[model samples]
Target: MPREYRMMTEAPPPLEITDLTTTFVSRNRRTEVVRGVSFTVRRGETMMLLGESGSGKSVTARSIMRLYGPSAEIGGSVKLLGRELLDLAEPQLRAIRGAQIALVPQDPTGALDPLRRIGSQLTEVLAAHGVERVRGAARRRAEELLALVGIPDPKRVADSYPHELSGGMRQRAVIAIAVSCDPQVLIADEPTTALDVTVQAQILELIAELQQRLGMAVLMVTHDVGVAAEFGGRVGVMYAGKLVEEGPARQVLSSPRHPYTAGLLDSLPTPGIARGALRSIVGSPPSVGAFPLGCAFAARCPHARRSCGEADPPLVAVGADRVAACPVVNTEAAVA
Candidate 1:
């Protein structure tokens, strides 16, 4: 069947999150990287978290997996299948880590050991999870997974070391290992960052295909809106560690409500738009420890007013399944 046809047929339940926060602490200071972020990902649904660098997209993913450093502090509730995850112990969390929620980190090569063969690494994952009884069974399962991810000559590729494979192949291998246990949620953190454009598309296609076949929820963290639009059923735009806008992918793309979101969309290079016509969000992302008093983007936002500088706007529902944390969008819509 065609890819588009398959996607249209598959739908999943929503994954609910509420008031999630992650904080990093040093010897003398503490900083919150993810500030009261909330959203949902239905079973088998793809939700893209879009943001610029240092926007806490990856940190939010890490917090969900409980992979933060020891000094970090986590708050709020993260529920899967209606069970609270924040209170789970380390060992309990491990049980859910791969079997319930798998992660495909940004760098495939860095994720794998250079000294170990691809097959061995996957086998270890299987063994750790008790997914396979013996080495032979694990090896066969690993080959099957490699094939599932569209890697050619799966057995041969499995026997090769991480250093021997191309960038795209290595990423596929990482993904295969991640899904070896068929987890319910797959967190892909910039899964195609290092690949060329063609390879990137292939990887995205593979992910979309696998999500459909496995019926798993996907939390995709990306800085590229185009990538988000390609795979995400919903998109959440984050700025300075907060989710500023979220809605259906098409709605968010076609008519972004938040000024920050508009600025981001404006920055995208288009064939019709003049070469230098793109407008960028001015100023760097605020340091996590030194976020502005009211709106994080207010300093650079053209629509900023006295009210914006006085109180942080809450994420208000603007449309069915659409929310924007912007006073301007909210006030304008209210007036209309």
Candidate 2:
């Protein structure tokens, strides 16, 4: 187990997002990609936003960092250590971005500048954040970051271009840059998606170690249940931009509440389950531009009722620190 996996309850929440919505406008039409998603990340803890592709996982993350372009219309509140993030000016936002809240994006290859050396890119971030005053100091700090992220021969690797490094090394270098300022919050959007299984484990372990050392809150967005189970303290299941289910990782994995969450767990490959016996969700995720009238997952949910198609269910408390947005749970509890 990585160091970050060691549970600690004394730390305060480093990041909080409340009723956040992100919409994209085009041709006088607007489509919401993130729909009032809210969650918190305590220092030294990892909260995973777990869902399949197009489930608004990445959109929610980008909204936190305010990385969406001009066409994007955002609402709601994001706070880093109780400071409002959405209302900040561009320059202020930039100052806080890498220093307070950093993002390790999904694609490392696309994130780095091909024309620049890795060391220079890392130094630019440090310089921009005012972490290092002199060019020589920035270079030294860059080399230290590379070594901290487990890159071999930090000096040699720092001088190399992004393209010269392997996929895993590039990803590590990106993580190094993201954590250079020792941010209070780290949002990793599918950081291990492009890597092989071995590399994935290594990267996850690295993140866990850094989180523990820095006491930073981590918002890890991933589609893999296994990864969430392994790395997340709390797991949130999103559907059509809404958080459908959330709870302690162990409870959620053992007994998922939402139909969609259950279906996702059922689809995971298990040791005892025969190779051909794997289950899959019945339908594709709904499009953001044209979501259904009621529950976004009602169209595909096996347990959906008449009320499920009428209105979106509110997230109701199911247990201590557990919430699920499903009418079935309420109906079942009422009947029982």
Candidate 3:
């Protein structure tokens, strides 16, 4: 059997999130962010959560790792290889974090401690995760991780603090830390947002290469359509904390079945398009806890009708291995 087929058939997926919901409570008020989101990422596969900022993409990713403090709330299931993470005690969760499931945060500078050297930080993760029991072995493994991430002169870079490295270098260090223990699942949230075009491409390529080499199930969260297009596995387009469209990345990004998805693709800067002629989605996304009565995107969607505001549209099959929550498109598809 092909590797992909066998990975799916032989065992459970590395990550499975079903009906995931996230809410925040402050001063006796509640605001929900992610709502009933569901997806599974198999071994060696990539699943992208794409949306405009504040569409709850980051919240969904962070919720999987249960990174929130006491003020936040989480519901639904987050499972890794059939082990539920949402209900796991902190001690047990600690064992899985960094060792089984790891996250590459958006801001590399913020993610890394300013006071710590890169090598020490890497070694610390190894020690905490019990990947290297000995002090010397842990230090050596830290350098090896740096080298694995394409950092030349790993020893020198490892000795340097985060501020001493360039943005791209720091990002590479973060990726190295995320993969140091060979995690079964990896969550990279906007990994290339702060870099220049050249560095961005390099970082993305490094991530893709590492995913292939390590056979990790990756959940890459980003707002860039180009990024989604490049990471061609599956894509979930989120809006107002709900997944509006999902399918094979090529299908969802190339020929969208949702108005929001179509509008997003249309807004991109294509070659030869004049700067002022770029199309844009007119309205702003709704804030959490302030969504419209029914379909959250209906107000901004061109094809929206009165009925669209009457009830939340369920994600229905629009194509092979695809689902979308747009009544107008679904109706048109049915008629056609």
Please list the C-alpha lDDT of all candidates, in the order they appear. Answer: 0.90, 0.91, 0.93
What ranking emerges by TM-score with the best candidate at the front? 3, 2, 1
TM-score of each: 0.94, 0.94, 0.96
Model 1 regions more than 4 Å off: 1-14, 334-336
RMSD of each: 5.3, 4.8, 2.6
Best by TM-score: 3
Model 2, range 1-336, lDDT digits (tens) per residue? Answer: 566755453444688899999999889799988999998888788899999889999999999989986888889989888888888889899889999999999999999999999999999999898899699989999999999999989999899999899999999999999999999999999999879999999999999999988988999999999999999699999988999999899999998878989999999888999989999999788877789899999888888889888999988888889999987965676588
Sort every candidate by lDDT, greatest first: 3, 2, 1
- After superposing candidate 2, which stretches have Cα over 4 Å from the reference? 1-12, 333-336
Backbone clashes in model 3: 0
Worst 10 residues of 1 by lDDT: 8-17
Answer with 1 or 3, whichever has the higher TM-score: 3
Over the stretch 127-218, how does candidate 3's per-residue lDDT look in tens digits?
88878869888889999999999999999998999999999999999999999999999999999997999999999999999999999999
**Top-lDDT candidate index:** 3
